[model samples]
Target: MIASWRPGREIRYHTSLNEALANPAPLVLALDGGVFPFRGALERLLSEVQKPGVSLAYSSYETDSGTVEALPFNGDITERFPFGPLRAYLSERLIPTGAERFRFAWEYHARLALEEQGLFPSAIPEPLYFHAPDLLPRPDLREYLDSRQCQSGPDLAESFAYLRYPPEADAEFREAFYAMLRRRGAFLEDLEPERTFPPGKGENEVMASVLIPVRNRESFIAQAIESALSQDFEDYEVIVVDNASEDRTRDVVRGFRDPRLRLIENPPGSIAFALNAGLRAARGKYILQLDSDDAYTPETVSRMVSFMEENLGCGLAISYYQLTDENMNPLPDGVVKHLEYDRNNILRCEGAGAVRCWRKEVLLEIGGFDEEFGNYGEDYDAVLKVSERYEVCRVHKVLYFYRRHQGSQDAVQSKAERLNAKTRIRLRALERRKKLVQNRGNKRNTEGA
Candidate 1:
């Protein structure tokens, strides 16, 4: 319940978080169920919270496996609560009047907002507590979605607030989020019209190209290849760019005798490199994504291609996908569609969706995927790039199968690795959004003149 090296001071217990926040103490420590502070943990948190203008403070914590260093505070914290156990000193006077009416679901929601109110966060450089594995929250997509009490709205702000903290669907919170984004200059009134692509589609061009970037995914490569080859839509080539796989991944591609499936070998490099190489070789008007470890439904290519073809303004098309086991059995969550894919809020969430299809000419115009992202955030970077310049629409149908198995790249990433990747990606996106808002303002000014 307490650290061994605790400061010899009187401590009081409150029945709930609200009660603790209501206390008149200069500092308060809030811990998740079964969280045990390590030696000197409270001392560190207390020191941080006592600093002038500090609203909330946190230190890294240990789990069953290892210590998780908390991510450094940033604008990304607005949408995602990245801290674990934390200390707070946000008395009612410190918060803006009427802000309390929002009734945030977690103390984090209230504390994070204080940053905008001129308060700041502090972090200790090391682990301070032990988080019991059993007590940790593992929120499933389906369960979380079903539990959300918010209604659908055309405004991305409402959805953003709902998704960020589903338990508190306050209208005031949604408006606050919108105002925050507007203040950051990341608010967008509308997407720019589609930029004109180069003159014409190249000679002998296919309607679409299913691009598969692979490395040591021999087990799943064949199924992914088959899914692309068996698509209901014709006139599409399956371009499998092997990133110097040490396994039989290339050989499996060779077994598929379909001329429509072409395997391009590349020097061992990042997924971005492999994808750029495929993009260069692709002769399709549209480039569809098919990961080596994932498969698509027979109509995925058709649906995505049709949607893009019908809507010339759309530069990127994202379709819903079904979560499956390694053997391809459907997961309990079933279809995972991010209905929150507004052009503006694309900066808020993870991404549009899986089975993304891009306009080949638009991909060329944007210079393909940015190799700077290397492997981790190339797709996300691409999405952000495309969304900025043109409309990104969604298809409601389940067009892809996202497999949750050990071999999938995302399935094996450490929490720290994911956090680092996300931080970089989000920072880049935030900058891009600011620029978008700036450019829009400049354009309006010119038009007014």
Candidate 2:
């Protein structure tokens, strides 16, 4: 029995539970016009519950989507509500102000109480409301809430406690609370860290091989290895091609001692030469080229592999990356944003080049790197060649960190060397484009004659 009623000016409520189940709307389904795609919310609610229990629901609505499900309420209301200090004050102070305020305050309190009681259902699994796209909070409601003062000491404590303590200390408090609950056997198994990687067997075919070409990256090499090994995606090997580093780079690689780490020695030379060596020895269906100083997010490989799998037509998948300083500190937001927007343009200007994860077969067919322009712009050259024949995708997530340090080749290289490398890259691009045009012209001439 779904019925929609408009209360006074801006408030509208659609109640369905009471009418549907005269016995007890085990699930109280509420809807407001502000929520969009209200139908999807209804469908999700119906799908989540196979068995019966008392369910109290509320939703945050968008202007376009009808309602976004808020926390589900099923268990003890008291424990879930007023469970937190901020909520307690809201219940104690805000509710007493007026009936109009009480309705809004009660809704907020009810949601919190439901969560604390372990009655809050996952809004993701079952959306009970849809929000309209352009939905905005009423100005009157906003003004009313803002005008109310938080009462005395309790209010001050709740507001300032978070600011006073460091996040780690707050985390410790939360951990202790959860630990206590765990001892009482109330902890959910899903809350535990999930192990996605399986133990290595005798001869498991590696799914991907990560080739990291390094020179004197002794400081961050370990971090790079750790990031790669810590990936959620297993079945991958890290091939560190050492370009004759005079530093303790060997010591750093040796310390890890993971079977998945394969150390290849490349005498002090070009980035292209070292990468080509790694490519020759790589034994994976897919290949990822990483810089020794760069670190990857745990989900980087997983996301790349998934993207590649889904998009069979694409030969390479490249993601936007963040630029970090020597110590791996991220650059300013404006700088990062600009770099991301310019990545495609940068790749195009250098020819058919882009940063990407490539199929090993496609890479091998391209005859590996040109070894001529060894260090500075070799990656650009290889990517240009690959992109000529294969479809390349640009994933707009910062999955990799391009670390900038004084010792980096980009910094140490002379202006002449940099200009030379850029020239080499442009020349290579022009050559490839010329060849393509000639082939097309030849074919057209033959067909016309």
Candidate 3:
């Protein structure tokens, strides 16, 4: 019996994608919730998928924000979901493996399976459907990982490469996944021995420098300074690199009477520029990150300093943080402890965490943060460079308060632009990692011969 009726076609709805793929229909159209097709959506998708070597086809869609262009498919769907509400697949191309276990993101898993088989999706650049604005969440790792108990054999192997193992993953599964990464040349087996710090021109007593870069954040600048000063650690200095603020941010920073707090005046420039200035003026052995609009926990400085001192091989470290509103009240799902963070999978993710601390020599050697990213992805660029050689470790405690307010940089930046900038960083990291792995293989071959 026909489960549902569509215009000029009978729709058989299956609970799982596996069942649908098992029974071949010449063409398959998958619609996400709240997706209303435009007049010619199906025709356009069908026309595109029928083309030679095209296994899947998808079109852009209209959202409350605007028309989201069908992002160019690069055959690597593991990094992100580029398709929108409407996706059409050639029935013969969809692999039944790994499709049944995914309660949510099943389509995503199917796309990954297709990608592994060298089947890439074709894109139609125009809007073909209306996607509900409220349906904004991408496939979540936790939601998919929860279904792991039901997965085994080929299904598990197909999904394993894209999975980020948090502490929540079973011990056996985590170990096996890590072993796979090592064999695939994606994982670094061990950290390099500790390197010597750059020689100091003069004697400096500061062990850590809490670097705060500001532009027009007068309201919260004082709180940030206060929190830094409140640190239990004594051998640390607080350096505020003021980026020619039009507001009273400079005045508030000057009001601080502590000798350890110093403000450096800089011309209007990118956040990276301000940060580089802070790095130059910093007298501490380690540079700690503290945004002008965010405050650190009292133990933040002490904990980070101790970790860096104890772990000689670690060049950079980031601590977990609490996501709060401007009033410091915790937002829903506020505690951001990125337990899924692994050095091997850093290429596939965003930055590790906030309250990042880096060895001064390591920052200098990597030429500091890349100013090309402007304010958007400087931290991630730096993180990628540092992690390539030295260890990038995590401090498991929440030692910073990340306040989300209208005045925040992320709040003001265009979402599309920010996403584009981050995607560029990820692509660059991918190339760099590929080169590194290739070099390692060549070296091993030479040594064996």
Candidate 4:
């Protein structure tokens, strides 16, 4: 076996395959700790590795909960290491899976590194290992991007190598990575219609309470208010929580004499706090959010309500939205159309559109928009929390207009602050997932003898 000369740190991963490469061992079976390989699992893996181009092989396994995660190998998803630890590898084809130097991402990067070199991992569609999935989420590019080193070079090349990205795409990769980083600040449409409510719902009760948390939005407040007032649905109210606006925002909202409109004088502070105030005052079964600077179409609320009504299990609903300038001129095409709720992709980008609606009960359960997240990331945090336990539906129609003006939060947020916010949100999401798993385990145990 080729022993590694890696010094300074002791992480328990093989540094290089050179030792295994030099040894006569034809096949190496890799299994994660706490995972039990079933009989013939190694043999089945071996049988596949003997075939051409099958550099690495992993098999489906039953999680501790008794359900199997029989995932097909997608080269892209290797970033998350969906291929759990029950695997077999050909000795000669082994790449530097990663050394003990950087403990976390090397494992996932190894999968990607191997794939970049045409080592497509072929999957064995049989249950091989018995283990529970890790409660922690896989490391994302943020792992690489969030390194606190003061860059001594124009680009992060050496760190890229450490992260196992191919050197050729450094410039292009930095651009793409930065592009996604820039987008972390954008809040997109991530909702629904219809007429039906649950059996106990009162006919006179508000169907949906559209909450607009506003502060100093004189220019766009009228448009937003008009949009809410114009919704075609029956039995809905608009609560414009004026967060101590210095401008004519209060005046603008007061100008509207609609009986359904209510104004709350919430002193300026956090948007989360404002949202909570609105929630406390909201009189509807469903709570929908509208930014002070954004607006909805006449049918946006109706459509969102209908969707949530039909998909009773969905705790939240967001729809597609068109990005336009302040004047409502449509932005050019190629904007990231957040059409689906890909769990991993959504983490990297807020593919969930901006216009969001939640079940009032669910909102209260999660403590109403997480006041800790404050200005930028509250919605994302809320979306993820509900999504982990309950389904989050995506409405295919663009029933909301996300205005991109000079005053837009994304445009105004400083780069360092944005990065810092995202870092915290990602960590919190992981921590939340871990707690969720623990909670599930505890519930199941309590229900047992």
For all candidates in order, the CA lDDT equals 0.71, 0.54, 0.73, 0.65
Give the distance in Å from residue 107's predicted Cα in candidate 1 to where it truly belongs: 5.0
- Tens-digit lDDT string for candidate 3 (291-345): 8889999999889988888777888989999999998888898998877666666
Which candidate leads in TM-score?
1
lDDT of 2 at 158: 17
- Listed per candidate, the RMSD to the true structure in angstroms reads 8.7, 22.4, 8.4, 17.0
**Which regions of candidate 2 deviate over 4 angstroms?**
1-205, 334-355, 444-449
Q: Which structure is stronger by TM-score: 2 or 3? A: 3
Kindly list the per-residue Cα lDDT of model 2 for residues 103-149, writing each as its tens digit: 12333343433333333433333333333223346685334323432
Model 4 alpha-carbon drift over 4 Å, by segment: 1-200, 334-336, 343-345, 438-449
Prediction 1 TM-score vs. true: 0.82
Each prediction's TM-score versus the true structure:
0.82, 0.51, 0.80, 0.58
Q: What overall lDDT, based on C-alpha atoms, would model 2 receive against the true structure?
A: 0.54
- Which of the two, 1 or 4, has more TM-score? 1
Answer with 2 or 3, whichever has the higher lDDT: 3
> Using lDDT as the measure, which candidate wins?
3
